[model samples]
Structure formats: structure tokens, C-alpha cells
Target: MARELEEVKWEKFKLGDLFRIKSNLQLNKNSFVFSENGEYPYFTRTVFNNGILGNVHYLDEEHKLKGNCLAVGMIAMRFFYMDKDFYAGQFTKRAIPIGFSLNSRLANYFITVLNKKSKIFQSSLVRNFEKVFKNEEVKLPVKNDGSIDFEFMTSFISELEARQISELEAYLVTTGLSDYVLTSEEEKFLEIFRENEVKWKKFKIGDLFEVNSYKKRFDANKVNILEEGHPYVVRTALNNGIRGYLKEDEEFLNEGNTISFGQDTATMFYQEKSYFTGDKIKIIKSKYKEFNKLNSHFFVSAMSKSFSTFAWGSSSFSISIIENQEIYLPIKNNEINFEFMETLISAIQKEIIKDVVLYTDKKIKATKKVVSNK
Candidate 1:
């Protein structure tokens, strides 16, 4: 049996008319704070990861006295989204519904729709807040009885979420094993080959590769669906650290190139495909034959972890340090067979692709169920 798409009536509403955008109150560094095991969770802008927080900052009695703080089910919109409530911080624009109970699930759905519609909120920086606010409008669907189907909507989303989490877990396990296999073999070979016939030579990264940065910028409107052979890399893709070419604006980067994050506080995993984005990302072309032997995952793991240490503790350190950093390599004419290593890596990559496809299929099936119910 099929549930027919019902003709649902929707009311047009300006978000500003029904919601009050609250200004964030800053907490002083000197304020009293509680330990991790505190009485209440301190809410902040970062708490808006899909409208839930696993861990929260804490505030003491005095800090809590400062009024205008939100309670747990309050609808928040950090930025312009359809109706999804997001936790607001000093940086994000917060919204409070005027006369309705905060329906967190409904709000999340609206935000998801808005995100699908535009990419304005993808970046933390607000470039055109005024324009975005003025142009945005939300449509509230009404049931036959003129009331929201809160339970049905929530259940619909919950099913999808549960399915996604399961698929993600499976994907993680398969990829982790694949990575282990690739890294373990690469390490074993390097140790054996390096010791036998070659004297290790140290060289700076800049001496072996041509580092380039793309200067052209594209707006959200200019981006297209990620397809093969298109240039795309952004902060979020780097954050995903998946191996595959991303679909993005054709004008963003030079065709057929590899990129790595250079500036993020968190280490990004390397993927086989290019389509990554981040401010501190490095784009490189290897000038040496050994450069092809440089496994993307191994290199990114080393750089991200090392660079993050420097960024957190030292102000003078920059990714430019890579240009001067020493790397130990085997002598050119030695019996080190890089081609054999590449073949092993390629096999590992194929296994990863198989896992990704399996996970993707599960996700698609789950998505279909949710969409059908809707």
C-alpha cells in the first residue's frame, strides 16, 4: 500500500514576525565556572551540532544569575535556516519563537530544508546577513485539524537518524580496517627497504614538491552538484576527510590536483579524491618520482597532527614550516620498489570503496523510508 501525498495547507510567515532573534550575552573569563561534572550545562554557539550537545561548558551560580539564557527545548536558529532551531552563541544569530512551544524536531527539519536551498550558512562568517534575512520565508504545514503533527514528524526524522548512525558505524569499521592494512604494509616495507640497500637522505617538503594555493573564490550560487572532473575543495570537505573527487565549481582549482588542509585545529584524514576546502590547505604537485610514493593518508596524518601542535602552542609556527621540515627518504637507485607499494595501497583503496558503497546503500534505503512516510 502507498500513502498518497496529501494536499497539505501551509501558512506563509515571515520568520521575524513570529520569532525574536536574541542577542548573545558574553561570559567573562574571570567568571566562576564549574567542573565537567557540573549541575547545569552551559550553552554556547558550538552546541548547535544538529541541535544536540553531548558535552557542555559549565557556569557557576553567579554566571547563571545573568538572565536571558535559554532552557533545554527552546528553538534556536544560529543563522538563516527555514525553521530549524540551533543553539546561538555570540557569533551566531539566535531565534526564539514568539508564541509557540519550541518544537525542536520541526525546527530541525526546516533548517535542513534551508540548508538544502542555500549555502549561506555553510561558512561561519556572515557575509550578507541582511540580504539573507530579508529574503528568507518559512512555510508551516497544517494538518486537516489545523494543528502540527509533532509526533509523526519527530518519529519520521528519528527513524532516519537511527538508520544513518548504524550505517555510519559500519562505514567507520570497514574504513578503519582498510586504513590499518594499508598503513601497516607501507610501514613494514619502508622499514625493510630503507635498512637494506639505501642511506636515508633528509630533504625539505618544498624541495620535493611545488606548493600552490588557489586564489579564485566562488559564491554559493556558483557551486554545482559534485561531479567527476570538476574542481572543488572547501573547509567542510576537508573536515570530512573522505577520499574521492568532490563536485564543486569548475573554476575553483586547477584540474587534476591534490590538496591537504594546512590550518585547521583538527587533523583531517586524507582521501584519494580531491574536492577539499579549508583556509590552511596546501595544494601541491610533486616534482620527484618518490612524491608518488607519498601516501596521501600517511602524509596528511603526520602534517595535521604536527601542525596542530604548533598552531595551538606557538604563534610563530606556520605550515610554511613544511617547506623547511626534514623528511627522511631512501636513495634514488636503491632497491626500494615504490610501484609495489602503490599497488598495495590501490588494493586497500578498493576495499574502502566497497565499504563506502555498502554504507551508502543503507543510507539511501533509510532515506527512502523517511521520504515515503513524509
Candidate 2:
């Protein structure tokens, strides 16, 4: 993909030069009757869901933006490439390809460029996002004669899609390892050595780990700044609980790899760097001896699954409730089978690595072929 972009000549052009833009028609929110069984998607000025507020029964087929059109949110200033014919309601803008033809793949790629540009125009000074995007200039790949390279764009996107699919497949395989799924041959191999009764040991979380609560306060505004810095984040559902990064300063608190959790959100995260945390974030570390044997990544994965058992229907998790939580472990002889835990995680990592390597090789070859053809 990088080679293709490098080979092609690029030309800078204003967004209005490539697209015939249209601001959304004045349609009241009351007219959109959101329903579960609706046919058309009602689009609004929101960042998520391709700006889709909800599915509505309203039918304005002639006025609705066609599939493969780019929709820019006026309020959030984010770009979304519509995949289906949808209703474009109030406070939105649609950009239809003009002169040059664009497939779904190329339009999707353009969305990235537009979104990056939108990020730069932040501040109340640039209140009208639609107006700002209209005049923004973008550099696009062009052929030798300086025409848009649609073929290269399509192939480049396909290459990226293939790689992403492979990574997701690898993730799925690794995550599935926690639940033992034995093949027929493996099942038979273990049958001969399988013991009828296995020893189990139970211990409260506090017994094996140090639950330290830091009293250092982080200013919510400074810590939550969405910029590249040392990770000073609170926990959330996305990106393994990374809300955002923050800068390192005297006020910076917490360090080392440990299991972190959002007490309010009841989500688990593995923090590997020195960072600060929000009010409800709790950090748990294994005892000096236990840390050597226990794998933090494996512990995090297990704890995430166990969250439901403890949290139940509650949205928040109390520190008292978590410290007293007891966990079961397999015992060999009289001691905890730390080797078993290590081996299990190692096996999963090996399998996932194999899948990732194989897929990466295939993606490289495919990308080379596309570049060579050009």
C-alpha cells in the first residue's frame, strides 16, 4: 500500500473540486418516527452510526443520498461513507463524487483523509464544520498523466482489508484458547493420563495480591486530554479501557505492569506504563513472589470474564467487594500449578503468532502483486 502511494503522482485539490456538495434539507426531528421495523435509516448530525439516528418509516427515496456517498457530520465534524441509500436529515452535508468516479473502497479511503483534516480545525473559532470541510484541500494519488488513480486506491484498500481480517481472526483464535477445545487425537492422548479427581485450591484475591489505593488526585480536564503522551487514562469499554493519553509531569502517579480496573465502569485493563488514573480506577498487583509465577495478561483476561459474577447487574464495582473476591486454581501436589497457567497462555500466544505470521506473508505477497501490476 505504501509503495503504491509512493509510485503514484499526487495532486492537491479542494474538496469542492472533486465533490458536488449538498447541505441537508430542513427536516424536523418530529417527522422522523424511529421504529425497530423501519426500512430507511434516519441520518442526523452525530459522529457515530454513519450519523444514523435510527431507522425510520419515512420514505423520501428521491431526496435520500445514494449509496457510496460521503456524509460529513456538521456537529461533530466527522466523516462517514454511507454504504446504503439513507435519509439525510437536518444539520448534515453530503458530498457526491464529481467528474471522477469513486467506488465504495475509494470513498472509504477518502473518509480517512477528510477526518484527519477535520481534527486540525478544532475550536469554537471554527464552529461551522461543514463550511470548513468545504474549502479544505487534500492530496490524492494520480496517474502518470495526472488523473486520479482509482485502480490503485481500490487495490490498496483491499490489501488493508485483508490484513485487518487476518488480525481479527488471530485475536478470535487466541481468545478461544481459554475454554479448552480438544481435538479427537488430543482427547485420546490425554485420556490415558487423565486423573479421575483433580485437586483445587481457593484463595481470596487479597491473599495472593496487594490491592493498593493511591490518594493522588488527577485534574480530570488535564488527564483526559486527547493527545499523544504517557497514558493517564480512566477505564472504558473501548481500546482495552484506554480513554486517552496524557503528558508526564510531577503529578504523574502509578507505574509498572499491573491489573487496572474502572470501579465505576466495572471493566478490566492491563496498564503497562507509568500513568495516572481517575477517581474510581483501582490498581491490583501480585505479591513479589506471586508476580514471578503469575502472568498479568492471563490474569486480566480471566478477571474480565469473572467481572459479571461479581458485578452481576450493578454498573459499579466497590473496592471492598473486589478485595474479598475468591478465585479457584488447579493444584499439583500441595502447591499452586503456576506452570499450568504459564503453559496455557504460552500455547495460545504461539498459535496466534503462527496465524499472524502466515496471514502477514500472504498480505505482503498480495500487495506486491498489485504494485507490480501497476
Candidate 3:
């Protein structure tokens, strides 16, 4: 059943009236030791990755901004809902609710309002929050008797979250991850190979794939980065490493389906679209007509694990080493078991998709219940 939204009464209020503006402690960049595995998150003017520049273990509770507060970027009009107690970097400010307990979801609502209002004040290096935003009028949901509707705000966010989760689940489905899983019969059948009862022949990497020694054709001058153009740009990373796009180019490097590797990092990526490779990228495609995109992906996954074995950790990653390498694939009666490869990928994808879909479905249902009850 569709949840019907109650009539919301919006009341205008100045920014200062609702929340007490507070600036974060000025900690120098060097004072904080950055690490991916750090205890606490350190936030900066970084608009990307939700303002988390890096993680740190700064144990100053007095200086740290507690969870469920809004962090506003000083220079840029960037805002994020700091859900965890975070160490603030230089040039950052936060909002403390005047009298109410600010939930992170509710803080997200306020950040949305603040982001739209503050966009006009952006681009300037210096920012006077008191002058620009302190008295800025904004609307908030209110009840029948002229009180803030916290429940409605929570429900609104919850409904949106449900929809977003469904969208993500749909996306996961499109990735072919939700296609199929291994049945009991299929799993038992593969136990023979797992037990090493079936002998599989090893093949040299050079025999399967050959690197396309194409010169880099990406020129920033001729091919401008577009909002939506041919995905003529790809890097060595697995996903979303497309720096820019190109409309037209003389040497548009496009291999229908191939594996790309970073010459220095040994970082591998599978490319399906026609895209021009960035600097230090080595492209390799299947030498045999039997192999396709699915096979390339499985090979890339296998090769990614063996990156540490290569001598490229000290020096530049040699394509020659990868070319001369050997990989083992399941073989039946002197032929590659392409069906087994297909089933293997499908089973793996299904397992991942199953977990994600289960979690997301539960969240959506829970959020929907909250919405419906409200």
C-alpha cells in the first residue's frame, strides 16, 4: 500500500534561530596523521566522498564534533551530515541545534536546505557565516499547533531511503549479479574439481591474450571534457575512473572488450565500451574467438590476486611479465570448460547480489513500516 503523506505546514525561520553556529577547532594538517585504517574520520573542504578527506586517530573529545551535527565547509558552500564523532580539519564549521536533539537523518534534511541557500555565496575564498547565513530565512515542517514536525521529517527521509534502496537493488540486478545461483546439484558437481579429481590443463597468458600496442590518443586540447559524451576516457581502476569524455578524435582507441592494466601499479580493469585509455595503461584482448567479455572479467579477477607475485612492486610493472605469465582454467576432455566458467561467475555474482538485496529489502521494508505507521 502507498503511504499517504500528511499535510505539512512549513514555517520560515532564520538559520541562527534554529541552530547555534559553531566553528571547528583549528588543527593544522600536519598535526593529524592520516591513515585509511584510522579510528576517527577527519573532515575538510573536500566536497567529494562526503567531506571525509581521510581517517585519523586524534583522541581529543573536547575538540571533536559529536555525531548528528552538520559540518559546513568554510570556503566552499559544501555541507555534510557528520554521523560519527569526527576530527575537523582547518576552515570548517558545524551547526548545533538550538533546543532539539538533531538526528542524523534530520540533519541530512537541514543540510539539503542549507546547500541550496548557500550556493549563491560560494566561489569566494573568504566566508563570513554570520553575515551571509545567520539571518537567512528557511522553511521547516511544522505541526497543527505551531511546533516542529520531527516525526514527519523522519518519515519523509525514510520514504526517500526506501525508494533509493529499491533503485540500488535495481542497479544490482542490471549488473547481472542477481541473475542466478548455484543449485545443490550444480554445487555437488563442482566438488569433483574442488577436490582436484578433474585434471585441468594450464595455458600460457601470451597464447590467450596479446597487448594492443596503441599510442595514447587522449588530448585535452582537442577533446574537451563533457558532461555527457562518448566515454572516450578510462583509467586502470575497476570502476568510475573515467576522468573525461571525447566527442571526436583521430585515434579513438576502442577495443570492443578487453582488459586494461596500469603499467606502473598493475591495477587491472575490464572495459566493455569503446574508450581511449589514459597514460600508462596497457590494453590486452582475447587472441581466440572463443573468449569474450565474461572470460576477460574472470581472468582480470584471477590476475588481480597475483599482482604481488610480480616484480613490479619495486620498479615499473612490466607488461612482458604479464604477457609471459601462465594461468590455470578448468578443462574437460582437452577443451576449456566455458560452461563451468559461466556458471562460476554467475554463482559468485548471485551470492553477492543475494546478500545486498536481502539487506536492502529489509531496510526498505522497515522504513516503509515506519512511513505507513506515521
Off by over 4 Å in 2: 1-3, 61-63, 120-134, 177-374
Q: Model 2, 220-319: lDDT tens per residue? A: 7654465687666566677766666766564556755776777866677777676777767788877645554235666666566566666444656666
Winning model by lDDT: 3
- The runs of at least 3 residues in candidate 3 whose Cα sits more than 4 Å from the true structure, single-residue gaps closed, are 1-98, 101-104, 110-156, 179-181, 189-200, 220-222, 238-241, 311-319, 367-374
lDDT of each: 0.48, 0.67, 0.72
Worst 10 residues of 2 by lDDT: 184-193
Candidate 3 lands at a TM-score of: 0.61
For candidate 3, give the lDDT of residue 54. Answer: 86
C-alpha TM-scores of all predictions: 0.43, 0.56, 0.61
Clashes of each: 14, 0, 0
Residue 181 in model 1: shift from native, Å? 12
lDDT of 1 by residue, 105-189 (tens): 5556555654453444343235454345445676766566866555545654566576676666676666554243445655555
Clashing pairs in 2: none
lDDT of 3 by residue, 326-354 (tens): 77777888887776776666556666677
In candidate 1, stretches whose alpha carbon ends up further than 4 angstroms from where it belongs are: 1-7, 13-29, 44-104, 110-137, 166-170, 173-201, 204-226, 230-294, 300-326, 329-374
The order of the candidates by lDDT, greatest first, is 3, 2, 1
